[model samples]
Target: MPHGKPGQAGSFTLGPASGDVNTAYRYRLTSGSFDSGWSAYKPGATATIAPVPPTSGTMVLFAEAKDNYAAGAANSVEFVVKEGDGPVARWNFAETSGAALDTSTTDQSLRDNAALAGGAVRTDRGRRGEVTVTRATETTPAVKSTDSGLKLNGTTDYAVTSGPVIDTRASYTVAAWVRMDVPTRNATVFGQKGVNRSPFYLGYEHTSKKWSFREVNTDAAVGTPFSYQRVESKRPAVPMVWTHLAGVFDAVNNTISLYVNGELQGTTPFTTAWAATGPLQIGRVHWSSVYSDYFPGVIDEAAVWQEALTDTQVAEESELIDAHAVPSVELVTAWTPAGAQGTTLRDTVSGYGSDLALSSGASLADDELVLNGTTGAGTTAGPVVDDSGSFTVTTQAVVDAAKILSKPDGYKAQILGQRTATGSSWSLWFEKTGTRQEPELDENGDRIVDENGNPRTTPVPVGRWHFGRLTADGTGASVESMEEALMDTETRLTGVYNARHRTIQLYLTSDQQASDGIAYTAQVGTGELAVGKGYLGSWANFLPGRLSDIRLWAGALSDSKQVSDVVGT
Candidate 1:
């Protein structure tokens, strides 16, 4: 840091003190409040950071030199500076209800700028979407800290500013963290709504199968046909995954460009430009004078700059937001056979000592947990579920249905469960319900009648596995499978609870579609989560079987197509 005099040029030059040919450097500017995050590491030449306005008039510069093997400690210096420009408009979407409060100082009256509509709402359940290469630790690239953002249902949900927020015809930039749920055609994430067509649309484009930042090259004229050209990202759009998108229009450069996760994608040379003087719309598109292509996901940390953002600044912005990505869906715990040891079933996902103790003479058969009907295999280690939120559980088990207690309908058993003493939260059950009585079938598929040639109305076991949910208020329901396994023929079961939709669904390997389930609307009950047993007042409803490879997730799996990949439908 040169510590240049006040009013001097604000650009700071960063140079490596010592380095090899492969050495690279990354730098950032911060004051105590606002930070410029970090820029992309560049090799060889020096890196320059122009004035990134801080809330205060001071800025702190930090630089780090790194090679393939090692990284140097960050060296920083402080500087007092003059004024600089900030975002023209910014929304954190931190509000739980009401409009998005514009935090930018563009104008004090524009504070309550964007209004929520069509059931669009704010949620603390925000940050990045659920997609990670593996279980993340503190040092991984995946974000650990959580953030808040806006949630939108695909049908009719959006947010619109009272007026236009940017100049479309001039050099400008827009950026946001988008988590798309559905790959709807031409779904718009953010743009300025125009009378004939939007000036810019940042969203997932179904035709190209990519996250795109598109700018309409022309607008519809009176009585003339409406036509326009645009630009889009090259990276494929990943549904239910969080990624940053930045659309840049450089009038001086005569081009429009887009960035995905801070990496610059392809650019398009453009000359035609128009001003669409309409309110800024989030999660929707207005094309051909029609309002549709509504976004089907979440948008957070949305912002717009009056000038085109440099590649370094865009990278910094992506890094800044990525650090706070919330992983809503994760494997909270996995109790596998490999983790079996003396007196315990270790959580394979975490580590040793974090295990479910084997008690009441519970034994292991080839590393699989073997428990008797009355002897439960419970855990005090993890209540793997957030009883009130979404969850998915899977287990490979061989059950002896003959050991299960009988009911008037038939035999019933609780395979896996987690609940409080007052009520049940969720459970996987094997139930035999009353099905219609029909004549017995012969080996040739013909009805086998008894005496007098009359068809006999014999009963059949309608036994099936199910996923059920019980609220603390005593309201509950289950989704039963269509498969029959009443005679010790069960091998595996999968259960899912989607808190957002308030449904408990079950899936079987033979089924091609997810089963329709009853509404599970209620608050989460308090208690420890366990395997191979259900709990009410005491340790009862124990499952007698070989249980292993138990996996648990904090969030529910998606539809049949997405979940089939996991549950192996």
Candidate 2:
């Protein structure tokens, strides 16, 4: 039989009859001839038939009784058809050192065409790597078990090619299995673009930490600021871990939807006219002006579809990614990345204390260290809290500077940075010293006033305070805040390491209640967790603000109703 399940259908074909003039062929079963009659045989035309299997057991069919000629010997045949059509474009990323190939039926292949020569970064930690690709004894899905994946170094690594033009204004879906190194910045997963007013893009916003789907329409006129239509997930993506992401745009309904790990995140109405006419970029946006949106991390089984895949299909795709993920539950160390300026980075939980002094430029202002970005500040002991398995770390602070914390390795392991440099993480920031507003200017450079005869201009926000908590655990990582800052009372940011769930949860509140929060899978590394100042060599990472009441917990805090008691909410 062809290649189908017990109750599935299969198609069979018989060769064109030959051997004599006016010859014909008829097919039959062992019991009797089939009800469908056969006719004259042509030189090239073959008879095709589709039949559903009656039961699980095998069945045989016979062919070749010729017409106007002597009967020929019967030929037996079998047919089996499998269920489901595969992805339109699927990249297994099995190639370790060369171009990324498309394993889909479209033959749309992509080579390692990095725009910059030294841009592509190669690592051995792929899912199906030199060793991890081994198959399990149990019956696992083939797509999930196939080994190997690609990792993109945030700075420049990405895979690009042209030809697969999927219409964003029509029904379509895009999906991928992603493992982010640091989930910040406007990181693009995959997009096609060429400066055509508006294009389709799926990316994560570093400042908001939310997954977004955007369709641009530059032709929009005034009073329609909604020209840049988008549907953002209600929550942010967990940093430094693997997650399944899928976005579907249905033009008929003028709605867009996003899914994380097979769950429907949210759906919103969005109507816009846009087009994309550039090379299909895997890790970055195609527009040259916005190269900063390049994806930073590993992507596997990236795919695109001409039709919106049903929720069921997205669930199956998510399962494929989960099969390869191995959960970790070990706690390496936990500490708040904030302390007195010019002092040692003290550990609150594991007590893996470090006497490593900070750079002289670091100064204490109201108990928190103020870094000038150029000054070096961190623990002297390298890899102070190194753990091979898993870990959870949490800290809370109010920062005015944008690049609040970074590691020494050229800002490679940044802990937290402002979403927008001028603003704080949780609070609205206004520069300590700046004019709030000026007279509004017209196109002719003349001052314009409103109907009330006053300067018709909006107040420019110059500064704002920023505050929030940062968490990193085995399941994932995140920087979170309670939407706004609590001016009178301090907000508590809590991170819990649930090894059993192989995930980390983040909570933010001022009333000591761990209410609704975001959770993500964690990223594993041996690098030491630093605080206050990062990018030691460059002098570009310094808190320049205060850090207070930093503490840590040993493991996943018990799920007690009084969560605030453990880590003040």
Candidate 3:
């Protein structure tokens, strides 16, 4: 009878035309009774099949005989709405072409029959055509031993599984967050091929605690290493502290950049062109089976991109990382109140203005100010200002007071002196300043004089109005100076100070022509000096201008550099 019946009741099969069989046929859904007449099957045919709504339990399909049109031919298919209907399709990696490596085992396998009917395929896992790469996790190398609480042995090398291969000829950026149990040995974190078999790499070394970026030029008969720059952390990397690191190569600009904790720390130029072949590896050197310089730490959130990140993006990322790593702390500067003894105001500059008022019971003579758990004291004699207007005289005493007052145990002071036309050349002294005399003086007044009896007057030049900072640590101090004019000559002296009471007297001799004769000049002001006393002084005509910022510390500042920072010449 040469008769034909539907393959499956609901399934329809279209016949190809005698000559043109490649044309596609379209299908659409139609509204009709389940028992409607069968549609013709032909080339370029279009058919409409209505779907059974969920409310309907199931849909049955039957086929009518064709070719001679025989009736009552039993060809029917049934589909039921049951809990389990085997997956529509499964994927097999072995059957898939271009799969470099596939790791699927057990009855549910990537090679034999792995379900793909539900989700998209992972491209990196050699399953891209089906789905986009959504998420991935890279684990740190296993640890071998512990050195100073840091893992000592672990592989850092890795191979790109699948995705866009790194093109050295193109620009790219790489970033990662690392928490080393121990410092990394000089080793490669990441790198790829460049011109003449040269490779660009970002790495760190435990010995120096420095991170470096370099390019290897194998073009030389002997391989040549071209280092851009190495950045050493100002402070040593603490154990287990996660540090964020990043590197970027701009092929267009011929520049390479590096960032730490989102902060761009170093950059270099790449005059030579980059090659296009080598595989991307992390933690270990490329193509090396032995893992010697492996990173021994935890790494999270590593990323690579084809474009350089903007400075704003980098800063934002750095801030985000900092927030996650160290959070912020509230910083407050205040002063102790007068009459209340130890009571201190939350805001010293706010309540007392420029004058840090101490309680009457507080001893200004002690050269110290105790406020909010911080203690600061004066180092020299000039720091002392009595009820009487005159200041005691002594170069050593004045410098000492400046030092101690600059970084008081709990407070800091700013220099308010201006450049006087007097021929007396005084150098600004701080830790870094090359001035001869130490700003701090010992109990013996002889400290300022060298064996030669010279005044040790390499005047730390203070050309313009500026403030010097003195940071105190226990009995030591560090000094830093800042001024508006670059021509300002200032020396920094950082050293220890003794916060004892001593009167500062400014001497005016006719020949010296030093003193401007005002009984109470605007230049002098008073506040905390030593722990027990506060100072009050009137400049008179000696130097005109209101005393600006006066502060005292509870502890001694002994660092010579710190002292120089407190008062610049």
Model number with the top lDDT: 1
Give candidate 2 regions above 4 Å deviation.
1-85, 106-118, 127-147, 218-226, 287-290, 321-569
Which runs in model 1 stand beyond 4 Å of their true positions? 1-84, 128-146, 221-223, 321-569
Q: What ranking emerges by lDDT with the best candidate at the front?
A: 1, 2, 3
- Which 10 consecutive residues of model 1 have the lowest summed lDDT? 320-329
| Per-residue accuracy of model 2 over 302-361 as CA lDDT, tens digit each | 888766665556655654522334321112234344444345555444323434355565
lDDT score, candidate 3, position 16: 37
* lDDT scores in order: 0.66, 0.50, 0.33
Per-residue lDDT value at 362 in model 2: 53
Each candidate: RMSD: 20.4, 24.1, 29.5
Across residues 15-69, which tens digit of lDDT does each residue of candidate 3 receive?
A: 3334432223323222224354544544344334443222122444443333323
- How big is the RMSD of model 2? 24.1
How far out, in Å, is residue 291 in model 2? 3.6
| Residues 55-129, model 1: lDDT tens digits | 234567767766566775568887765332557888878666788889886568755378999999875545433
TM for candidate 1 is 0.45
Error of model 2, residue 39, in angstroms: 51
